[model samples]
Target chain A: MITFLFYLPFILGFVVIGVWGERKIASFIQDRYGPMEVGPKGLLQTIADLLKMLQKEDIRPKAADKPLFLMAPLLIFVAIFAGFAVLPISPAISGADIETGVFFLLAVVSLDVVGVLMAGWGSNNKYSLYGAMRSVAQIVSYEIPLGITVLCMVVIGSTLDLNELSSLQGIFTSETTYLFGIKSLGIDVTQIGGILSWNIVQVPFSFLIFLIFFIAGLAEANRAPFDLPESESELIGGYHTEYAGFRWGIFMLSEYAMMLLVSFLASILFFGGWNTPFPNIGSVTMATWTSGTPGELSGAIWGAFWLIFKTTIFVFVQMWVRWTYPRLRVDQLMSLSWKYLTPAALILLLLCGVWKMLMV
Target chain B: MDQMAVYLFYFFGLLAIAGALGILITRNLMHAAFLLIAVFLSVAAIFVLGGAEFVAVSQIMVYVGGILILLIFGIMLTNRISSDKIDTGFGNVLLGILVGCAFLVWVGDYILTQFNDQKAALEQTNNQTEKLGISLIADHVLAFELIAILLLIALIGAAYIAKKDKEEVME
Candidate 1:
């Protein structure tokens, strides 16, 4: 119950601002003014939209499967929100610090596909079915590269615990590198905690893995460029064609929530999650910016701050990518995942393993 | 907590059984697919209750993620054969139900005979996944390697079949 209470406000606030940010950024990219009416700089526009969605009539198709149709959005919401249970915002402020946190997160998130399929099939619409079919294929295909790329990180860290993975990338602390026991690479080149200590920088070809993961994450979340599942140009609302009012709102909310989940995982896996980018300077205190002191309220605050900050950056990048790239054809999307990304990720996984064995 | 565990186990057990029944009764193939998810989720919960977090997660990932999606795809491709309903003759349905029930009773009798109430204590380990990983490479290496080899062959076979169909289309 406490977890639900905490997540309610967090997700609400994130979706509200994330929607606004996406629009504002989209308009900025096109050199047009975005929503400027509702609140200052159109900040309250999402709230107004939310109210409008709530008040609208909940319409159902006459031929649609009512139970599955109604339950799809709720199931998707539950599955996506359950992922938050294992994601550690701060050392002190996590939901559930399970041993299989990473695997559990992947498992819960994958359940969203079932909801998408349900929505697609229950609508009794051809467009909805096509959307659902595409979504399942896209999501299932991308999950391989996504899981293997995550395995790359797991192999490097030797742990599935998200918190442990995060702590392993502590700023400025160099991972011990053993060069065949002949002589240790004595110099601590990556001693400074920051981007340098991050797995993206620390491991060989990890930057490449990070990029593949990001691309796969975008496809998995059904974002634009891989948004064939909901390609508005082709299929009127994709799997959610028949949904209306609050149900549609829930779908959109879950989409953004999925975006946030992917970004959060990316930050945790590659970037120094909850760890400040600023390195410690002599006699200068920037302690508050880094990971918070565990068990301290101050620590949770900073931990939340850094984690959210890094996540927002990634979300912004996702929005940027969304507007920038044209949506891939369905064949192209499948080929990208299977032909390129899978093999690339496989090689990267092997490279990381070798790097760990030989260098560290 | 122990009582809660017992109740939770019963809850999931009933859910699993209910899901299986739903699958058996549902005429709609898609509905059965969805019901199968409930069975998978309940089984995963049972695994979690048994202190096998890794197994529980892998259960969700593999069964829910890979297998269910493939099953749905299979159903979709066979839509022309039967889209709305999968009708069976009444006599056949009754026969199928009777056979299913007989099998269930046999399984129950076996469980009753073989089950042990004196279970081993839960291991005090923070990271069961680490132990699992080590064992997979150590004691279970052959089985693991064989599974990998099987999957590789299956992948190759699938690719070859798909490619042949594409070539036929082109010709």
Candidate 2:
């Protein structure tokens, strides 16, 4: 419940900063100033937008399915928000301490497809239906590779608990950690304790897995390059085309929250989540100073700092890719998932199994 | 805590039944499909209450996420059924009620007879996923392998049928 409260405000605040940041970044990319009038280089621009949105009358189309249409935004928000319940904010703080935290998060987030379908069908608009269908298809298709990539990490980590996964990749782990997870090399990086012990460094092939996970995550979040669902050039505003006022705001909020959720998962899975990146060298205790033992208040603070730091970097990359690339054609999107990503993820899964065997 | 668990169990059990009834009565196919999701979710909740977290998550993932989406897609793509109202013809109402009542009675009888035994067995278990995994690999390996092969064959058959239809369309 505490984590729930923290995430609600956290998501709202992140969306505010994210919207402003995206605009500023896009403007800079196009050689122009973005939103300089609002408070402090337009930091309060989203708040202004929110106030304007709140005052606008909520409109429902005559032909729309009234209950489903009204229910769609709330359902979408709830489904996405539920994914955060399993997110380990810090070692001491997690929403639900379920043994299958990773799987539960994946399962809960995928429920948003039902909400998307409701929005599309209930709107009684052709464009909205098209957008929703495309969105669901893309999400469902991409989830295969996403699930496979995550399964690869699970195989390597041998645990589905996010907190346990975090501990395994940090200095606190008691087990011997080999370079690239090959026991023959016998260079234990457990004591070194930094990026060296991270999954990407410990299991080099997982870098490729991370890339697959990132791409799948992007598609799942409905961000650009895979934003065919909301391609404004053709589909108008997509699934939420019939929505107005704060309902539209809910969709936008869910999108940003989904972005943060994916970024957090990626960092935790591959980047030694909440663990400091600086290794302890001779006469230097950067790792120890940066990260405390789990359950300590200092640990929670430092953990959140590093996790948010990595997540911010990923979020920036997502925005960068969004602005840089053109939206994928429908066929191109399907082919990328079924032909390329899924097959690659499968092979990577097999390789990860071998890596796990070697580690054992 | 145990009282809370009992209340949750009853709540989800009633929710599942209500959702199923909603699906039966709804004239709109889309609304029925959505109500089916409610049923699936409540059943998952019931699984959670039973201490089967792995099964509960899988229930949501497979039923709510995969199968229900496919069902919705089927409804959407079918021009005839996509209309606002579906007849869902009322045939053999008496027979349906008879079968339903008999099945309910049988299930109730079995539950009443075996409840204490099952409760005692369940109380001894923890980390259901690990136990499930070990049993799947060690005791039920053949059954697991057979199911996997069956699913793989079904997937290939589906792809083949879909591809054949695509080729016919092109021709």
What lDDT tens digits, residue by residue, belong to model 1 across residues A186-294? 5453435555556777774778999999999999899989999899889988999999999999999899989999999999999868767775455553543565567
Worst window of 10 by summed lDDT in candidate 1 chain A: A174-183
lDDT of 2 at B38: 94
**Chain B TM-score in candidate 1, rounded to 2 decimals?**
0.85
Off by over 4 Å in 2: B80-83, B164-171
Winning candidate number (DockQ): 1
At residue A213, candidate 1 shows an lDDT of 94
lDDT tens per residue, model 2, A126-225? 8999999999999999999999999999989888888789888878788887766678887877877888889999888788999999999999999999
Against the native complex, each candidate's DockQ, computed on alpha carbons, is 0.66, 0.64
Where model 1 places Cα greater than 4 Å from the true spot, the runs are A171-183, A189-191, A285-292, B81-102, B121-124, B165-169
How do the residues B1-171 of candidate 1 rate in per-residue lDDT, one tens digit apiece?
389988999999999999999987777777888899999999999988888889999999999988998898788777762156544324587788799899999999988887655355444466688889999999999999999999999999989877856567898
